[model samples]
Target: MKVQNKIVVVTGGGSGLGRELVLALLSSGASVAAMDINAAGLEETVALAGMNRGNLATYALNITDRAAVEALPEQVIARFGAVDGIINNAGVIQPFVRLKDLDYAAIDRVMNVNLFGTLYMTKAFLPHLLARPEAHITNISSMGGFLPVPGQTIYGASKAAVKLLTEGLSSELLGTNVRVTVVLPGAMGTNIAVNSGVMDTLEVKGGEAPVKMLAPDKAARIIIDGIENNRFRVLVGADARLMDAVYRLNPQRAARFIYDQMKALLPQ
Candidate 1:
């Protein structure tokens, strides 16, 4: 569905790809309700909006809270009169550790934000989306969702759940007005590591992190394009694209390749 003149809700809109997505959607003439847990980050996003700020509204809420997520539809609909699309972009990663070393608290936080949060938003807005003349849902999974990333095993598992959830929702909503698109994004040059608190635990808090990533604006554009075209699946970066093909060809080899690359990030 075309986003022009449409009301779209974007979760994780405080910063990173989510902020860029909000700005991009506004530029495309879509009215956006940007939701995030970071009020300061939301304010920063609004400041960055400039002329497009008029079309954007910011909400501070935790997507992991099901009650809060359920209440969000009404709040957004009241602001925009109706809703046409939802981008479940809010997610967090697990700490760099093996599952055996990972605590249940960390696992729950990752699963709650990455998996259940997406599920809650989808369920809350799906009925409303189906009632619309035309609508769309975009869920952000990750390259790790498809390929094993060693230290990020649980993070991958959560995103993998999102991958299947989106595909399954797409299957279930066939012939309906609601269209579902799943996004698998490779690393982007964002503060996700900082924001998710992983960087705090690591020694490399400086600018010496390995692996250059795609720009957030570029990723937002690709995702928006996928939503506009109602694509079944969208891969945001070359890394994700290459890895997808590699994983399909030989899952074990791809897993090993990724493990070789990411093992350095894990604690020794």
Candidate 2:
């Protein structure tokens, strides 16, 4: 579906790729409702839109809250007239530790924010999207969802669940007006560690040959293009694209390669 004139809601719109998506959508003539937990960040996103600010609305929301997510459709419609698409972009990572060392509270937090959050938002807005003549839903998974990273096992698990959930949703919505797309993003230049509150415990160190992370703006563009074309899966960054092929050809080798690269961060 084309984005022009459509009203779309994006979670995690305070910063990172989510913020970029809001800006891109506005530039493409789409009205956006940017939702995030950080009010200041949302304000900053709108401010960055400048003249296009009128096409954007900011909402400070915790997507994990089912009641709040369920109520969002009405609020968004009141602000933007109608909801045509939703991007479930908010997520968190687990601490850099083995699952044996990881606490239940931390595991629960990751699952709640990453998996349940996406599920809640999808369920809440699916009806509204189906009502639209052309609508789309985009869920952001991660490269870790397909390949294993030693220290980020739980985070990978959460994202892997999202990968399946999105694919299943796409299959189920096949006959409907709503289109579902899942995004698998590689490492990107974003403050996800800070946002996930894992910065102190988890430091992403560069290897001997450092991998260049993709920019948020570029990632956003790729995602938007996928949505416009109603693609079932969107892979962001060269790393993500490479892994997609690697995983398909040899899943075990791909998992081992990632484990070797990331095992340094794990507890010795």
Best by TM-score: 1
TM-score between model 1 and native = 0.97
As a whole number from 0 to 100, the lDDT of residue 49 in candidate 2 is 98
* Candidate 2 structure quality by residue, lDDT tens digits, 94-138: 888888999999999999999999999999999888888889999
TM-score (all chains, Cα) for each model: 0.97, 0.96
Model 1 per-residue lDDT at 46: 95
Query: In candidate 2, which residue ranges exceed 4 Å CA deviation?
Result: 204-210
Candidate 1 lDDT score relative to the true structure:
0.92
> What is the C-alpha lDDT profile of model 1 across 14-105, one tens digit per residue?
99999999999999999999999999999999999999998899999998889998998999988889999999999888788888999999
Worst 10 residues of 1 by lDDT: 201-210
For every model shown, the clashing-pair count is 0, 0
Q: How far is each candidate from the true structure, as Cα RMSD in Å?
A: 1.4, 1.5
What lDDT does candidate 2 reach at residue 117?
A: 96
